[model samples]
Target: MLLTFAILLTTAVLLVSLSRRLGLGSVLGYLVGGALIGPAGLRLVTDVHDIAEFSELGVVMLLFLIGLEVRPRRLWVLRRAVFGLGSAQVAATGVAIAAILAAGGLAWPAATVLGAGLALSSTAIVLPMLAERDLLGAPAGRTAFAVLLFQDLAFVPLVAAVPLLAMGPSSHGLPTEVPWREVGLGCAVIAAILLGGRFLVRPVFRAIGGARTPEVFTALALLVVIGTATLASLAGLSTSLGAFLAGVLLSDSEYRHEIKSTIEPFEGLLLGLFFLSVGMAANLGLAVAEPGFFALALLGMIATKTLVAFLLARLAGQPDASALRVALSLCQGSEFSFVLFAAAVGVGALDQEAADRATLVIALSMAATPLLFAASERLVIPRLGRERPRVFDRIEDDGAPVIICGFGRVGQIVGRVLRMRGIAFTALEKDPAQLDVVRRFGEGVYYGDPTRHDLLRAAGAERARVLVVALDDMEEVLQVVDIARRNFPNLKLVVRARNRRHAYLLMDRGVGDLVRDTFHSSLRLSELVLRDLGIPEAEAGRAVALFRDYDERRLVESHAFYTDEKQLIQSNAQAAEELTELFAADQRRLESEAAARSRVGAGD
Candidate 1:
C-alpha cells in the first residue's frame, strides 16, 4: 500500500511539472499520466476503479470553489449572452445533432438526449484556461463563459430528464411514469440542504474554526461536503448536482477560502486518479477493432459542432471575430457528455453498445482538446482577424508630456483637471477587461502594462515631464516608481498612497511627490471651513500649503523607521501627529512675530 501511494505521488508531481514546462495545461498531463499508468500501458494503477472513486474528491472541491464565485450580480451582468447566446448555442446544436441522429435511425428521445449531451462543453476545462491566459471577461471570453455557464446550469435538467424521458407512453401518469414524488422529494431535499448551509453548516464551521486547528477545520469542512453529497445521492439526484449545491451553500461562509485551500490538494490528487481510471477503462481492444468508426465520430463531432457554434453565435448578434472564438471554444464534446450518457444508459435510455459508443466519442474528443485549443491561436485567430473589430480603437499617446498609470476614481479626477486645461497626456492600464469597458466609455486610454519598460517608452516615458503612479497594486506601484526613477529620472513622479504606511514606503523608494490618503481631501477642506469661517482666504491657503509640506517631510522621515513593526506604526501615526502639532505651533509663532514686525514698521 505504501509503495502504491508513493508511485502515484511521484508520477503525479513529475507529470504535472513536465506538462507546465512544455506550456501544456496540467489537466492534459493528468489525463496523459493516467493513460501511461493504467492497464492499457504499464498497468501500474492496478486498482483503477478504487483510485478513480477517491479522485472524485477533485471534482467535488472544484465545483465547490466554482460555486463560491457564482455571484448573482455577475450572472445578471451577462444576462444577454447567458440567455441569448448560450441558449441559442445549446438549442441549435441539440436540434442539428438530433436531426442527424434521427436520420441515422435512432429514436427521437434518444437522439434528442444525445444531441443535448454532446452540445455541452466543459466549463471546468475551458473557463480556467481562458482566465489563466487573462482572457476571461474579454469580448470573446465573456461569450465563452456565458455559453459554459448555460451548460453547467443545464446539467440539473439533463440529469432529471434522462429518467423522465425514458418513461414510455403507457405509463404517462405524472406520479407513476414521471416520478413526481421522487422529483418533489428531491427538490425538498435540495431546499433543506440550502437552508442548512445558511443556518446550520456556517455556524458549525465557525465554532470549529474558533479552535484554530487547521486540521479540525479541514476535516469538518470535508465532512459537510461528503455528508451533503451523500444525502443528495440518496434523494435520487446526481452526486455531481449535490456536489455543486454543496459548493453554493458554503459560498457565503467567511471560511470559504479555508475550505477551498483545504480541499485543493485532495481534489488535485483525486482528479489525477480519475483521469488514470479513464485510461484503464479505455478498452484498447475495442478501439483497435473500430478505429475507423472512432476517427469518423471524432471528425463529425468537432466539425458539425464547430459549424453549429459559429452559426448560432452569429445569429445571436456576436461579431464575426467573437463568433469564431466561441465556435472553436465549444467545438469539442465535453466530459459531462460521458456522465450524462452514462445516466441515460443506466436509466435505459440507451443499450450497452450505445453507451460504449458514446463513451468512445467523448474520450476521443477529450484527447483532441489540447491540440485544438493550442492550434487555435494560429489556425483559428488569423482567419477570424481578417475582419475588422466592431469596437472603436483606443487613442494613441501622440507624444504627450504626462502619462497616468491608472484611471480609477483618483486618477480620473486628476486626468479631468489636466484635460480641462488642454494638457497633452496619455493613460496606461493593465486590465484587458477594464480597458474594453473604458474604451467604450470614451476615456481613450492606452492598453498596456505600465511596469514593462517598452510600454513605458511607447507612452513617451523618456521625454515625458511628469508621470503619475495611481495604480492599485502596491507591489506593481513600487516597481513602476523604481523603474521610472531609473529610466526617466528627469521626469517628476506623483503617486497615490493607500495610507501613511504606503506613503513612507513610496517616499523611501525615492518618490518625492505623493498624495497620501488623498481621498480624504474633501473632508479636510470641510474641516477648514468649519474651524474659521471669518479667517482670511490667504491664511487658509497658507494653512493648507503647510499641511501638505509637513506631510511630505513626515513621509520622508518615516522611511527609515519601517523595518521595526512597532516603530513603523509609531512613525506613521504618532510621529505624523506630533509633527503636525509642532508645525501648527511654529506657524502661530511665526505669524505673531510678523504681526509685531508690521506694528513696528507702522510706528516708524
Candidate 2:
C-alpha cells in the first residue's frame, strides 16, 4: 500500500513540476501522470474504483472553498451572469449537442443525457487555469466563473433525472416513476443543512474556538465538511453541492479565513489525486482503436460548445474579444460528466460502450484545452487586441512641455496636477473603454498605444521637456522609456515601476528617476499602523524612514544579482538581520538619552 502511495506521489510531483515548468499547467500534468502510471501503462495502480471514490472528496472541498469566497450578497451581484448568461449557454449547448446525437441515430433520452453532460465544462480545470494566468478578475474570467457556478447547481437535478430518463431498469432494477420520497428527503436534508448552518454551526465553532485548541478546531472543520457531504450523499445529492452550501453559509463568518486556511492543504492534495485518478481511468486503448472517430467527436464537441458559448456571450453584450475568451475558456467537457455517465449506465440510460467513448473524449478535450487557450493567448488575442474599436486618435502637435504616455490611474493624477498648474501636457491611453471614462470627465487623453514610435513622435516627445511612463504594463512602460531615451535624449523621464523587478529593469536602462508605484504608499500605511499601535508619531516616522533608506539601498545593491535566486535570498536575509540590529541600537540610544535628561533635570 505504501509503495503504491509512494509511486503516485512521486509521479505526481515529477510530472506536475515538469508541466508547470513547461507552462502546460498542473491539471494537465496530473492527467498525463495518471495515464502513465495507470493499468494501461505500468499496471501499478489497477484498483482505480476505490481511488476514485476517495479522490472525489477533493471536488467537494474545492466547491466548499469556492462557496466561502462567494458570499450570498456577492452571488446576488452576479445574478444576471449566473442565471441569464449561464442558463442560456447550458440550454443552447446541451440542445445543440443533443440534436446532433439524436440525428446520429441515438435515442432522444440517451442523447439528451450525453448532451447535458458534455455541455457542462470542467469547473476544476477552468478555474485553476484562469487563476494561474491572473485573469480571474477580468470580464471574461468572471463570466466563465458564473457559468461554472450555475452548472454546479444544475448538476444535481441532471443526475437525479438520469433514472427518470432510463428507458427500462434492467441492471439496477430501478422504478421508472418519479422518486418523490427521495426528492422529499433531499429537500428536507437541504433545509436541515441550511437551518443548521445558520443556527448551529457558528455556535459550535465558537465553543470549539473558546476551548483554545487549534487541532480540535481543525478536526471540527473537517467534520463539518464530511458530515454535510455524507448527509447529502445519503439523500442522493451531489456531495460537492452539500459542501458548497455549507461553505456559502459560513461565507460571512469571522472564522471563514481560518477555516479556509485549515482545509486548503487537504483540498489541494485530494484534488490532485482526483485528477490523477481520472488520468488513470482513461481508456486509451479504445481511443487508439478508433482514432478517426475519436478525433472527429472531440473536435465536433469542442467546436460546437465554443460556438454556442461565444454567441451567447456576444448576445449578453460582452465585447468580441471578451466573448471569444469566455468561449475558449469553457469549451471542454466537465469532470461531473464521468459521474453522470456512470449513473446513466447503472440505470440503463446509456450503454457501457457509449460511456467509455464519451469519457475518453471528455478527458482528451480537457487535455486539449490548455493548448487551445495558449493558442488564443499567443495567436488570437494579439490580433484582436482590446477589440480595436476605433482607429488611434490623431495627435495635434501643440508642443506641450509634458507628454504622459499612459492616462491610467497614475498618469491621470500627473495630468490632473499639471492641469491645475495650467501646464500643457499630452496624455495617451490605449484602452478605449478607459479613454471613454476619462473623456466623460472632460480629460484630454488620446486613445493610442504609447509604444508606437510614430505615436510618440506625434505626441511631440522630441519637443516635450518631460516624458512620464505611467502605463500599467511594464513592457509598455519600458518601451516608452527606451523610445524617450533614444529618440528624445533631452526629455526628462518620470517612469512608474510596477514592482521590484520592473524597477530593476528601469534602473538597468539608466533611468534613476523612476518610482516603485506602491513603495511610498506602503511605507506611509505602515507608519500610520505603527502610530495606531501606540508608537509615538516621531518614532514611527523615524522607523519608516530608516527602513525606507535601508530598503532603497538594498534594492540598488540586489539589482546586480536579482536574477540569481540564492544570492537574492542571502542578500534579503542579511538586510533583514542588519535592519533588526539597527532598530535595536536606535532604541537603546533613545533610552540612554532619556536617562541622561532625567539625571540633568534632577541635578538642576
Candidate 3:
C-alpha cells in the first residue's frame, strides 16, 4: 500500500510540475500521470477501484473549502444567476444534447440520462482554474460559478433517477417513475443538515475551540464533514452536497479561516488523486481503435455545450465577451458524468460498450478544457475586440500634479485634503454608481480602473508627480504599483495597505510609502483610551509616537522573514516582547526624571 502511494505521489509531482511548465494545468498533468501508471501504459497499479474510492475524499474536501469561502449574503446576491440562468442553461443544454443523442439512434430514456450528464460542466475542474487565474470576481467567472452551483444541486435527483430509469417499463414491484418519497426524504435531509449546521455545528465547534487545541479542532472539523456527508448519503443525496452544506453553515463562523487552513493541504492532495483516478479510467485503447469517431464525438460535445452555454449566458443579460468566456470555460463534460455513466452501466440502463465510449468522451473533454479556456483568453476574446473605454477616458487631462487611483472612502478623503490645499489632482474610479454620485456634486472623479495602463496613461499618469493608490483590492493595488513603477518611474506612490500582511507585501515589492488603512485611526483611539485612563494627552501622544516608531522599525526588520511562516511567527512574538519591555523601560525612565525634578524643586 505504501509503495503504491509513493509511486502515485512521485508521478503526480513530476507530471504536474511538467504540465505547469508547459502552460497546461496541473489537472491535465495528473490525468496524464494516471494514464501513464495505470493499466493503460506502464501498468504500475492494477486495481484502480480502491484508489478511486479514496480519491473521492478530495472532491468532498474541495466542496467543503468552497463552501467556507462562499458567504450566504454573496449567494443571496447571486440568486438570480444561480436559479434562473443556471436552470435555463442546464435544461437547454441537456435537452439539446439529448435530442442529438436520440437522433443518433440511442433510446430516449438512455439518451436523456446521457444528455443530463453531458449538460453538466466540471465544477471541480472549472472553479479551481478560474480561481487560480484570479478571474472568479469577473463577470464570466461569476456566471460560471452560478451555473456550477445549480449543477451540484441537480446532481442529487439525477443520481436518484438512475435506478428508476434502469428498472424499465415492465419491471415487477418497481415502478418506472420518479420516486417522490425518496426525493422528499432527500429534501428533508438537506433541510436538516442546514438547520443542524446553523444551530448545532457552530456551538460544537465553539465548545471544541474553547479547549484551544489545534488537533482536537481539526478532528472535529473532519468529523463534521464526514458525519454530514454520511448522513447525506444515507438520505439519498450526493456526499459533496452534504459537505458543501456543512461548509456554507460554517462560512460565517469564527473558526472558518482555521477550518479552511486545516483542510486545504489534504484537499489538494486528494483532488490530485481524484484527477489521477480519472486518468487511469481513460480507455486510450478504444480511442486508438476509432480515432476519427472519438475525435468527432469529443469536438461535437464541446461545440454543442459551448453553443448552449453561450446562448443561455447571453439570454441572461451577460455581455457578449463575458458570455463567450463562460461558454468556453464550461464547454467540457463534468467529473460527475463518470459516476453517472458507471452507475448507469451497473444498473443495466446503459450498455457496457456505450458506457466506455461515453467515459472516454468525458475524460477527453475534461483534458481539453484548460486548453480551450487558454484559447478563448488569448485568441477568441482578443478578436472580439477590446473592451470599450470608460467615461473617464473621454475627459480631458489637465496634467494634474497628483492622480488618485480609487475614489472610495480613502480616496475621497485624500482628494478632499488635496482640494483644501489647492493642489490639482485627478481622481479615477472604477465603479459607475459611485462615480455617478460623486460627479453630480461636481467632483473630478472619473470612471476608470487605474490598474489599466491605458487608463492610467489617459489620466496623465506620465505627467503626475504622485500616484495615490486607495483601491480596496490588494491585487489591483499591486498591479497598479507594478505598472506605475515600470512606466512612470518618477511618480511617487502613496498606497493604502489593508493590513500588516498587505503592507509587508507592498514594501517587499518596492513600495516606499504606504499607510495601513486604519492603523493611524486605531492609534488615535488607543490614545483616547489612555487619556480617559488619567494619562495626560501629551504623555499619551508621546507614547503613541514611540510605539509607532518601534512598530515601523520592526516591520522593516521582519519583512525578510514574512514569507517564512515559522520564522515570521517567531519574529513577531519576539518583537512584541521587545516592544513591551522597551515601553516599560521608557516609562520608568520618565518617572525617575520627574521624581528627580520634584526633589530638586523641594530642596530649592
lDDT winner: 2
Superposing every Cα of model 1 onto the true structure, what RMSD results?
Answer: 11.4
For model 2, residues 108-205, the per-residue Cα lDDT tens digits are: 88899999999999988898888777667688889999999999999999998888887555566865477889889999999999999999998898
Query: lDDT at 406 for candidate 3?
Result: 91
Give lDDT tens digits, candidate 3, residues 1-604: 9999999999998999998787677878888899999988899976798999889888888888878867788789889999998899889989998999999999887898899889998887888778666577688899999999988888877888787777656556666676788888988999999999998999989898778888998899889888888888888678899999999998867567668778988899999999899888888999999999999999999999999899988988888888988998888888878778877788788888887888899999888898888667777777788452234446468989999989988999999999999999988888877888888988977777787788888889888899999999876787788778767999999999999988987886689799998889999999999999999998899899999999889889888888789998898889889989999999999999999999999999
Better of 1 and 3 by TM-score: 3
lDDT of 1 by residue, 1-604 (tens): 7877787777778986787576666656666776777777787878876776776666666666666655455567788888878888888888888898889999887888898888888665676556545556567787888887777777767778888777766654553466678889889888988888878988889899777788888888788777777777788665556667777777645566568667777765666666555656666666789889888877888888889888878887778877777787787677677778888888888777876787767666765666576577546666865432233234455878999998777677888999999997899877666777777878878777787777888788888889988898765677688678767888899998888767776766667777865535854784579457876666666666666666666656667766578887766677668777976797788789999999999999
Error of 2 at 275 (Å): 0.7
Report the number of the highest-TM-score candidate. 3
TM-score of 2: 0.65
Total residue pair clashes for candidate 1: 3
**Clash numbers, per candidate:** 3, 0, 0
Q: Which residue pairs in candidate 1 have backbone atoms (N, alpha carbon, C) closer than 3 angstroms, thus clashing? A: 34-276, 55-270, 58-267
Which regions of candidate 1 fall more than 4 Å away from where they truly are? 171-176, 316-321, 382-407, 411-429, 432-604
Consecutive 10-residue window with the lowest summed lDDT within model 2: 382-391
Candidate 2 segments whose C-alpha is farther than 4 A from its true place: 167-176, 386-604
- Superposition error at 102 for model 2 (Å): 0.8
What's the TM-score of each model vs. the native?
Answer: 0.66, 0.65, 0.67
Off by over 4 Å in 3: 167-181, 386-407, 411-604
Worst 10 contiguous positions by lDDT, candidate 1: 386-395
